[model samples]
Target chain A: TQTVSQSDAHVTVFEGDSVELRCNYSYGGSIYLSWYIQHHGHGLQFLLKYYSGNPVVQGVNGFEAEFSKSDSSFHLRKASVHWSDSAVYFCAVSARAGNYKYVFGAGTRLKVIA
Target chain B: AQTIHQWPVAEIKAVGSPLSLGCTIKGKSSPNLYWYWQATGGTLQQLFYSITVGQVESVVQLNLSASRPKDDQFILSTEKLLLSHSGFYLCAWTRTGEGTLYFGAGTRLSVL
Candidate 1:
């Protein structure tokens, strides 16, 4: 069974401030990690994904995430958040091989106040 | 590049009424399709998935059913919807040999 855990339910930051959202997963064997952002009343947009090679992956709109095997974690970060960046972020994981089913975290709602 | 589309951005249905939601995937063939439901401020739960035409796997049975009458198209339906069915429904698809899923705009359903 695959499961994802996102400890933080919410996070608040001021405009132009940096922020990081934490995510952890429980899965055996190799895995693929991904992050997605959902704006108000909009579809989810893929932010980034990590399969192998470099753990650090960059995504759209100045967002990036790092995959840490040692800690079983994949956390998303933004250099400077804009008010428009206020949205819900989700972390998901898939098996490295044939298992394509994705397990998603509960999500982290980020509020960027201007 | 692949794109997904869902219809009826919002809906208000009465109890015991039939409901139908549609989704289509473009720029990809024989992709894996999935339907998910998310209650307000709740975790996303996968309802069904299909890897090929005429074959769908249900992850959780929620008094609803799904169908893929054609490749690149998935439909979700409920004959008698209950108030518990009110929530956001999202449709997603992914190409073969890929793990990332592309999602639709999602339909917000309100069962009265």
Candidate 2:
């Protein structure tokens, strides 16, 4: 079974400040990792994904994440955040052995204050 | 370009009511389709997936069932709705072997 954990339930930061949302996973075999953002009352939008190449993957809206095999982690980062960046971020993992079903982490709610 | 659309933008019903939600993908043929449910403030859970017409796989048993009637159409239905069934339901699709998923606006269901 694959499980994803997001240690932070909520994170608050000021506009123009950099922020990183943490995500960790436990899987035995090869897996795919991705990040998504959901605004209030909206469906999730894909941010980025990591599979085999490049430890670091860049996504839309100036977002990027680094995959660490040693840490079992894929953490999302932004150089600077805007007030519009306030949203719920989700980390999801899909095992190649488990088909297309993805196991998602309890999301981290980000609040950017202007 | 491809687009996904879910019908009945929002629904409110009483428990024990029959429910049906529909999704259609345009400009994309033979794409993999999926149904996902999310409770308020919770992560999205995969409920069902269909790779082809008349071939649907259940990922989680939530007392709901899904069917693919056409290559581009997917339907989710339940004979009886439960209070716990109230949540946001999303329809998504991607190419086979591609992990990127594109989602629709989603249907918000509220069971009283």
Candidate 3:
């Protein structure tokens, strides 16, 4: 079984400040890692995903994530955050096998203050 | 382009009452469907997944069941609802062997 962990439950930062949300995973084989953002009372929107080829993958809204094999981590980063960037961020993992199950983390609630 | 639609944007049902939620995918054929339940302000828990018509697999036993009666439709239901069953229900679909998922607007259920 694959598991994802987001150590921080909540993160607060001033608008235009750089931020990084940590995500770590534990799985035996090839896996897919992705990040999603959920605004209050809304469904999650895909941010970015990492499977192969590149260690750093860019996502929408100037968001990006870097995958680290030795660290077993896939952390999301943004150069500067806007007030609109505040939302709950989730880290998900899925094995490359045919099974279509994705394991999601507890999520990190980001609060961007202007 | 593929679009996923979920019925009953919001529901308020009493405990022990039977409940049903529906999802339909348009413009996508043979997509994998999944049902996820999430408590307010909490993480998501995958309940069921279906890869084809008339085939559904349960990931966690939350006293809920799902069915794909048609290629484009997926249904989530339970004989009896519990207070704990009240949460956000999300229906998502992905292309075969693809990892990214497209989620519907979701149904917010409140079981009193």
| TM-score of model 1 (first chain only) | 0.96
Specify the CAPRI tier of model 1.
medium
Rank all candidate structures by their TM-score, best first, as comma-separated numbers.
Answer: 3, 2, 1
Q: What is the lDDT of candidate 2?
A: 0.94
Q: Give per-residue CA lDDT, model 3, range A23-94, as digits (tens).
A: 999998988899999999888899999999899999999999999999999999999999999999999999
lDDT of 2 at A25: 99
What would the DockQ be for model 1?
A: 0.72
Model 2 misplaced regions, further than 4 Å: none
Which is the winner by TM-score between candidate 1 and candidate 3?
3
lDDT of 2 by residue, B9-76 (tens): 99999999999999999999999999999999998999999888999999996999999999999999
Could you estimate the TM-score for every candidate? Answer: 0.96, 0.98, 0.99
DockQ, ranked from best to worst:
3, 1, 2
Candidate 3's residue-wise lDDT over B29-75, tens digit each?
Answer: 89899999999999999999999999999999699999999999999
Number of residue pairs clashing in candidate 1, backbone atoms closer than 3 angstroms, sequence gap of 3 or more or interchain: 0
CA deviation > 4 Å runs, candidate 1: none
- In model 3 chain B, the worst 10-residue window by lDDT is B94-103
Clashes of each: 0, 0, 0
Model 3, position A93: C-alpha lDDT score:
97
lDDT of 1 by residue, A22-103 (tens): 9999887888899999887777888999988999999999999999988999999999999999999999988878665788
